[model samples]
Target: MLRVMNERAVFGEIFRLGKVSRPELAQATGLSKPTISMALADLERARLVRPIGLRTGNAGRAALLYEIRPEAGWVLAVDVGREFVRLALADLVGDIAARGDERRKGGETPAELVARLGELTRELADEAGAALEDITLTVFGTPGIHDKETGSLQLAPNLPGWERPGAIELLAGVVPDTPYIVENDVDLAAVGEGAYGLGQGVDHFALVWIGTGIGMGVVIDGKLYRGAQGAAGEISYLPVGEGDPLVNRGRGMLESVASADGVVAQAARLGLEGLTSAKDVFDAARRQDPIACQVVAAESDHIAHALAGVIAVLDPELVVLGGGIGVQAGDLLIGPVTGRLRDLVALRVPMIKASTLGTEAVLLGAMAVGLTTARDLVFERAVAQAPPG
Candidate 1:
């Protein structure tokens, strides 16, 4: 027990400080020199730590600097989107060693999609010189709520046949004995923003994603608040209209009026010309076209109503706008939405900003998730492989 505790102390110090010599580690962990040596020797044998280089500033003789070996394990991060499947293969230290992306063909079956994901996983692992079984953690960012009970996805209409029984089981069966996770894409975006984007210093924030779909990712006290059954941030179901809540269960009332399809439909209703897509509508609004401006204003109002609910419930300190349409059309939406939200919600409104990570938010978030899981897995392995007390 003492040996395990000492090893944990030394490893924790190294993880927190990045690099340290034996003497510095001893000083930081408050462990004796011989104990530190033994702990380091055991860690090295377990392939968890390695000597990096000689410390330069020392006097008598240069002592060796040690760092956690990044190549000790691997993490696979996947972003499964409606049109594209993006992946990043990272090391234990969270450094991306390889990346690959492929566009989804129309009418592709669920089996085909799973096969493509498996193929991409193998290709990336091979490129990084890793075997499938060697991957320490695998995280999949999908566009729906993962139903842990049935082990299938829910509310993911974009990925057809994914909700069918035995689909998720098949996907999980592809990689045996590996720790796999399925997370909402937007939720992962919030995680990514927290680690590498605007939510760095803020403890309480909400990430609103508006695209083909609308969703929010809530972070409170610096941790994700996944409610009962992991549906905490499913804000699309907010009743902004006078309709019955029971009638608008599947794809929320707010999402029906504030998503990309909603924007395009509004533009079509306004008789906007050459507007075959939502981007054209936002572009027209940017150009100050009267009808396009009206549509954008209405969309902004709808989004504000949705955010009003978010603010009222979570009272987040900041609201981050992400997804394809949210980040691109932030300039046109922020002003009106902020103005309207101030009127709808009684409390102080949170500062709204566009995402800086852009399309890479979910991908980088997958990396963060994988990195977290990898750290825990590595530490557990270290403890289990420790010499018997």
Candidate 2:
């Protein structure tokens, strides 16, 4: 048990430092030179780590550098959006080995998407020169929160039949002989932001996605805060938009007025011509179309109202706008949204920024989540291969 703990510590230090010598590992891990050597030998035999090269600029003899082997384990990330399905393969060190995307067909059912997901997994693995069995962890990012207790997706109206019982089980069965994880797509986006985008190192922030759907991913004190029921950021249900809440549609009230579909509906309601999509309305607004400007202003107000409520409750340091319409109309909306926010919120408002990760945020987030688990799993597997006594 003691040896296993030492090996785990040494491996973790190596993973954290990227490349480390025996002396550095000993200092970082507080283990003696002989103990570090033993652990390194075990890790090398397990194929979890390897010596890269000699550190040339040292005072004494050149120390041998060790690094976690990139190909020791692999992670697979899948992002399923309303219109697209993206897949990426990452190694132990977070290097993307393969990635591909496919357009989702209209009216595609949950089962159909699951089938396609399985196909994409195999295709992605082959592209990366690995077999399905080579994947250490598989994480799927879908539109709704996965109910771990019931194994069913909840609050995902975009993909019909996904909320049904056994849907998660069905999705999990796609990857043969491998463990699979399902995470909320928006939450994954927030995770991606923290890992690689504007939210990096921000202790408290929120990623609000205003696109095909409406949702928010709240990171409080550097960790995701899913509510007691895992619906903390389901801001779509917030009654901050037009119409009565009692007449609840399938999608939430905020979503009904602020999503892309909502933008087009608002344009049509106000007699705006030729604006079929939110993108079209934004484009027209850029050309100074009066009608489009009104819709955009209203959209901005709706977003501001929702954000005021978020700020009143969370007081996040930064708010990141994401999703289809959110990213496209950020520049136009930021001014109005922040202006209206100043009028609404009592305290200081957070700096609102456009998502640096954009649409790839979910995929990148899945990769981050997958890689964390893959590291632990790979280390445990290696430890199990030759249990330390």
Candidate 3:
């Protein structure tokens, strides 16, 4: 019992401080020199901590600096989207080692995507000089809700063949026996923002993602509110459109007017023919094209209408605009959206900001989640293996 307690104390300090000498560990853990020494020895024997080098202070002798063995385990973070797949590998201490991204080919099925993810994972592990089995945890960020019961993705029409049965199982097969999780891309983005971006220090915030798809990630009281069935932030289906809500059930009214596809459709309606992508529309608007500007204005109004609904209900402290279009066209959207929102909502308008992390937000969120899960898994296994008093 005493050994376990001492071990946790020493390990916790090292986990937080990154590196520490015996004397420093004793000071931080409030333990005696002998206790700290023994704990350190045990941790080193367990391969959890290692002596990095020497720390020479203006004192009697040089103290040996110890750090958590970064190679003790690894974490894999994967972000899967219709157009691209990004993978990042980090150690137990959250130090990233390898990062790779691949543009997914058009017409790939979910099975093919899973295979691509597995290939990417192995490639990343190779770059990190680690094996797949060494990865302690893997967190996959994807668009749409992960239906735990059916083990399949739901409301993810963008990814072809993703809703098929055993989809989650296919993902799990990629990292067999490793602690694996599939999460919503925008939800992960919200976590990324909260942990490292504009949402930091704000207890209540929402991340609005607009691009190939539209979604929201809500953070309440510093915790992600996934809601029943893990579909809390499906803002795409919000009943705020002029069209018949019933007919637009799958695509949602707000999404029909606000997402990239919606923006392109609006541009086409405005006589901006041959606009291949939403970026072209934004570029046209930048050139002050009358029709493009009209479409952008209408899109901004739709965004504000949807945001008003979110602000009215959640009343978040800040709302972070993310995704390709949200961050790129921020200057174009913020003013018009805020103005329309002010007209729509009686409550105070939430502070709106653009995502600083950009496309990497989801990957960072995956790393955050993976690190957390790996640490807990390691500690839990250690505790369980300890002898009872």
Going through the candidates in the order shown, the clash numbers are 0, 0, 0
The best-first sequence of candidates by lDDT reads: 2, 3, 1
State each model's CA lDDT, in order.
Answer: 0.84, 0.89, 0.87
Q: Indicate which candidate wins on TM-score.
A: 2
* lDDT, residue 155, model 2: 85
lDDT of 1 by residue, 52-155 (tens): 88988757989888888898778888899877889999898877888999988957877788787889888998898888988888888998888877877888
Q: State the TM-score for model 3.
A: 0.92
lDDT of 2 by residue, 184-260 (tens): 89999999999999999999999999998989999999998888888889999899787533233788888888888
Runs in model 2 deviating more than 4 A are 244-248
Give residue 67's lDDT in candidate 1 (0 to 100).
87
TM-score of each: 0.92, 0.96, 0.92
TM-score between candidate 2 and the true structure: 0.96
Kindly report which residue pairs in candidate 3 clash with one another.
none
Colliding pairs, model 2 = none
* lDDT comparing candidate 1 with the true structure: 0.84
